[model samples]
Target: MNYTLHQLHVFFKISQTQSITRAAEELHLTQPAVSIQLKNFQDQFEIPLTEVISRRIYLTDFGWEIARAAEKILTETHAINNRILAHKGLLYGRLTVSVVSTGKYVMPYFLSGFMRQHEGLELVMDVTNRQKVIASLAKNEVDFALVSILPQQLNVQQLDLMPNKLYLVGRRLDDSSLLSDDPGQLEKLPLIYRENGSGTRSIMETFITDHQLVVRKRLELTSNEAVKQALLAGLGYSVMPLIGIKNELLTNELQIIPIKGLPLQTSWMLIWHKDKQFSPVAQAYLSYLRANKEMIVQASFDWYQQF
Candidate 1:
């Protein structure tokens, strides 16, 4: 009936990620170590807590109950730790952030200044698809999420960060005909699309539908990086966020095709669950963002525009 807080913490991570390997990675432990600890934790209980089906881990009812309890315990423990830090006038703690895949390009600049100012803070950044990022926020797994599109289902408090300009990009080529701005020509171009559930994909879909752009031939890729690679190879044209292709655009490896009603603009937003309590560190970071948002966006776009 006795279990260490460490075991409970690991179990909570496993439940949150739904994967032993991912939990191990997040906890900075080896997979075998995580497995051993999990086994040891289970040995203390008479009933099974988890099961694996088709390579996916599922928590039993007992495991779900334990996980819920563990989450509350861990949350309270963190709150206590934050209170102690506050009393000491220390701005030191872990700050976890989940960002959409395209955010990988620009979030570092925003985080770097904050981390430098608060040297004692630990930053944990997870870059995933929009759906997973939203899930992390909803589960209270991360302190904040950076994304272009906000979820309609979640009650979240959000700060608008910057404009996320999406452009029609392709390999730089000599044929000027490929850069036509005519919307009717869209039907003839080979369009590369992001996978379903991607925020970028959703935006692109809306743009296509709104403009009535018929994409006769499209190749669906899983990531912005993949779509960029496909474009570089002259495989197809893709509507990609400017942040993701800034380097390529600067180097002239890729060119934004001049198209009518182009460069679809969406705002990047920093969001958190409205009811979730923020730690001191999270609060400080949020304040820092509010105070420096203009400079941050300007700096990012300045860099992007330089080339």
Candidate 2:
């Protein structure tokens, strides 16, 4: 009735491993400490929970019963936590999130609005590539992710927020001296592309293959800035997300290449694991995303539709 959660977790770990030393290693505690806790539990219950023969620990009948009961208790405790956190206007918890670098422009504005609504929440954001985002989501390292596409293996619950269109960008639209204005002229111009495992890169590849377009490989870069610099410097033209080049488009630092079927259409999805339970902060943030969905779509997403 009065056992600590740590003690219950340790009990489960020890029972599963069937080795106190292994359990201690898993829990980052000393062997003697684990042994003492087990002994304390046995004394408190007035029953022998463990029997050691030939230096191997085996759970006795009572030990098995307590371990099973501990699992149920832990499960109920987690359910209670979820229910309590679900109450309105009670958003206080840690929310770890990951997003592609291209989404930085759109995600921050939406997240800022959510933070204002839930002032008590703590936020941790990781700007990583698409592969890392998927890996982190499946490992439960991040509570949620805003990504172009979720991995197939993950049991992801996705909300399609808005579509992102890919654009062929260059230094200026007037500088048609480099590549032809015709759509099939993509084969002649040098192409700047993102590194492998990038969501934008994957989308680009699919679009190119589908449209039967070929490009002369000019340069490869990691960041969008690098890609922009390369285009501005007239090294090569590149396909990039419209969101990433809003400022460049406004300042006339970069221009979209005039070609039919140039901007391939793809949507950004707000995704999280289907099996995992969301905390108060994460749920609140999701609600905020859905509520202001139009504003987010209009902010940085309108550029693609304009073309």
Candidate 3:
């Protein structure tokens, strides 16, 4: 009862990040200040909330419970604030979103308009691989997730946004003989691959399997930028999202390899957990996306084509 919302907020950040340093950085507070607030909050509880083990912070059982309650309290508080703002015919609230790495290329375009319209809104975005993005959504750590491949394990509500096309690209070599539609030739070329758990990697894997094709993987990269660099360096051919490689393709820095059954097509989707209670801000964004989906997609495609 003695604890304040400020204290709860600090504790919640620490619980989420599991590191005082990171929590402090995100909270924009000095490390010592965060430590003092945490200590004071623990005094109010009169129970051990967290402990340092092997130089890493781990939450105690009580800490976990408190963190969960803190999340609910914060969410409800934000909902109430949003409702008040709605009554005033104003929009002002924070929106957190997570997207897979490939989505990074297109998500900014999708968000720019909405963000411009709501100058008072705060937007936090996490760009990670598909696995981490899905995990964040599962934990309710983010309000929405943008991805091409939806997890089969989670119950979620999704809106299809735009077409996501992936192509096989490599440095344009003078050897025209290397360019062929024969699937067997793929095994002879050095292939650049994405790290495991990448949605693009998964799709590529399936495509390879279905076609009974083979590839000589020369490198395993974790990010699109790295892969693009490797491709530019002629390290190997790679399956990459067109959005990520549009500029390269336009400039002829990267050439799409014509292969049998290639240019795999998928749809970008916006997803949220089925059990989540939407705040007014979340609802507003969702409605905005629904209304402008076609325009957004067209604008993105047009932008890419110009590159």
lDDT of each: 0.87, 0.80, 0.88
Model 3 accuracy (lDDT, Cα): 0.88
lDDT of 1 by residue, 66-152 (tens): 899999999898788767767888797899999999899878988989998876677999999989999999899999999998899
- TM-score of every candidate relative to the true structure: 0.73, 0.67, 0.74
Deviation of model 2 at 24, angstroms: 34
Weakest ten-residue segment in model 3 by summed lDDT: 298-307
| Residue range 1-307, candidate 2, lDDT tens digits | 4668878888888999999989998788999999888776677787788899998999999999999998999878766765575675465667888888787866776677777766656688888788888999989999888898668888889878887778888876444564565667678778899999888788777877887877788887887778888988889888888878877888888888876776777777878999878876677778878788888768746665665
The TM-score that candidate 1 achieves is: 0.73
Error of 2 at 146 (Å): 1.2
The candidate maximizing TM-score is: 3
Cα lDDT for residue 281, candidate 1: 87
Please rank every candidate by lDDT, starting with the best. 3, 1, 2
Off by over 4 Å in 1: 1-88, 173-177, 305-307
